[model samples]
Target chain A: MIDSIARPTAAIRARPVLGAASVVALFVALWMALIWSPPDAAMGNVVRILYVHVANAWLAYLAFVVVFLASIAYLWTKRPAFDAIAVASAEIGVLFTGLTLVLGSIWAKPTWGVWWSWEPRVVTTAVMFAMYVGYLLLRNLSNDLERRATRAAVLGIVLVVDVPIVHLSVTWMNALHQLPTVLRPDLSPTLDPRMLASLVAMTIAFTIVYAYLMTARVDIERRRQARIIEARA
Target chain B: MTIARIWRIAAREALAERGHPDGFVAAITFVATLILVESLAVGPLAAGQPPVAAALFWIAMAFAAILATTRSFDRELEDDAIDAILALPGGRDALYGGKVVALTALLALVALVGGLLSGVLLSLAIALPGHLALVLVAGVLGLPPVIVLFVTLALRLRARGALVPILALPVLVPQLVAATNGTAAAIVGDATGALGWTGLLIAFALVYSVLGLTIVPTALE
Candidate 1:
């Protein structure tokens, strides 16, 4: 049913090159950016947190985009393969979100004078982490493949709708959280060019890592399903 | 024959699944305990900032809301009527809607009762007529949209009871943030100033209501 629509070989082949060159190019860029970027006079060595923290946060949304896309494909095509992709994306999204939270905390302890803040961004990140964790746990608890995929697809799509709202909430709460400078219309060079280079590099590296993990996870699921069928037959 | 009658039957069947009294007692007891803890926790900081108490108050409410949501669907699953109810004449939307209303009403009733008592406990002593009343009503009313969302997610969630906190907590962030802002403004004596927060809460409530309406049926289907 799935192979008729998507040649598994294409997806499987598309990974090694897209994933590897992208990752290698990414890390080299990070080395050039981080070691070469000028450090701010205000927070000397500590600013390194920006590269990791920012990239992880970017990846969180990226992973969700994948989960969303895969879910849409599953619903439209009714493909088991796409359901596996959605699950894989969600799982990766959770890990990256955790990384974001941890990096935020590490950065905060040194800069914000406290480990945690009621700031809107921090709280929403924690919430996103928990929501996706729930998504994965729900998938694990269900036994039926059709039921699990259908349910996960529904939950996955519904939950992604909350992300932008969470981002907006930090500003809406009038709290300590700052708005993103990079994506907004107005940009005053927030960081020196090197740090920006590091972030850009890290972003690509993490994305490649995300793709590799998702493919591996989905392949694991596909094989497990195949074995189940083989055992039955 | 009518959609109205279908709604009524759906409501009645859902109601039959969950018999009330015990859940009411549990919610009340939990909130009473929360109110006590809030009063004590903020008492030391009370002199520095009254608004902190208001913020503390709503955090407690958020926790209590989660606790109460479990009982909403726990009964149906416990008595093994969930599948039968899903297969009802109108299908899962009707049942999900009925559950949402029942849970929202139950949460509101409990939150209202507790909010009344917490109002006396906080004793901000400021002219919070606008802020206090708005926060009081909105805080309780604000819960239904949230309860509907979490309960809807809980339907498919593994560890439904345990999963409530996980799924609901993230979605509840804005609600909590707004409640804190609105209540803090009220507690600090600018009840009118708190109106913005209340308006935002209303907006959130509307969003969640639509979200619940749109998504719950799909989850059920």
Candidate 2:
């Protein structure tokens, strides 16, 4: 099994294809977001940040969903590959979450006139970021591979289950006494068709980029595990 | 039979804590110090407000729960008692339940002390004492399973002191939010709102308890 995983020739062959596709998609996404998309009537050019920001946020969540599923798979199968996939997705998820925060801050500055707000989405995303960072930290606490993976998988499952609850609680925090309709303005304004197209393009591009990163990272993890096994032998 | 075993394990844990009450004392002290410091930072005026007081109260309880639960596992680890426990039939789930029970009890005490202290220091009036107590119970119920699971997962790791909080706090955010808001609602006599938050807290407790039982065996391995 180790040998089969170590020599994933098909995946190896697909890496460059994924890389090239991601690059092409990203360039198209950037062109559409920066130029093709019309500026928002209210916020003007600042709205361009939404294309990338929303994509990053969406993919960050996707990465965590991958982590959650892979974690369950790891636990059920006790397979090293699933563990590798979970950890890689977690790392990428953290990076994307960080990027989402920065981009949101950038967008917030120009639009909301503040770099940060205690809005529900902002608070929820920040907590999500912290939770996964803690996941990575937990992964580092143990030197034993199987043990580490098992523990991290357990945590991954718990944290993923927590995301919706965290969002709900944060939303209710601000809207506790007030009627839902009287609460803060909806963050996503009605988008122009061109803007919608750009948003879709950016999301696809980001997903491709996530796929490319996961493939590379999982390969590295597999090799690392293989090296550990060889050393024991 | 499983229920009996779980109860016995929980009773054993309580007996162990009775023998050495240091962990309980330390946790209460930590909660007191945390509330005092937070109140000092927020100043007398803002700290006295119901919302701020509620937030400070739950925040202290959450951290206190972490301290208490981590020490509970640490005591088990010191004597290699966890392995002995796991050697029994259905031990993993029993152990999880036992820890959750004991920790919940211990944290409840910490919450009581923290609540009284916050009320005095933060000038938080309880308009509906019974509802506030119910909220505290629900909130405390939710914490132990999470604390037990994470602390058990971190038990054998290096830097566990730092790791337990890091791994547990973010997951505890919702509980903190619900407990804080519920306490605020209860303090202001909003029984409806407080009950709503209490329901959320109970749901959180039930979910994590079930999840903890399912995962503890794997976590132990």
Candidate 2 local lDDT, B61-102, one digit each (tens): 888888888888878889798899999998888888988988
Backbone clash pairs for candidate 2 read none
Q: Give the lowest summed-lDDT range of ten residues in model 1 chain A.
A: A1-10
**Could you report the Cα RMSD, in angstroms, for every candidate shown?**
3.7, 3.5
List clashing residue pairs in candidate 1: B131-B191
Q: What is the lDDT for A115 in model 2?
A: 91
The C-alpha TM-scores of every prediction are: 0.84, 0.93
Model 2 lDDT per residue over A1-233, tens place: 56966876566569999999999999999999999998878888888888888798778888998999999999999989999999999999999999999998888886777898887778778889999999999998787888999999998998887556443554555632112221125745356778888988999999999989998999999898888777776
DockQ of 2: 0.82
Q: What root-mean-square deviation over C-alphas does model 1 reach?
A: 3.7
Cα misplacement distance, residue B220 of candidate 1 (Å)? 2.1
> What do the candidate models score in CA lDDT, each in turn?
0.71, 0.86
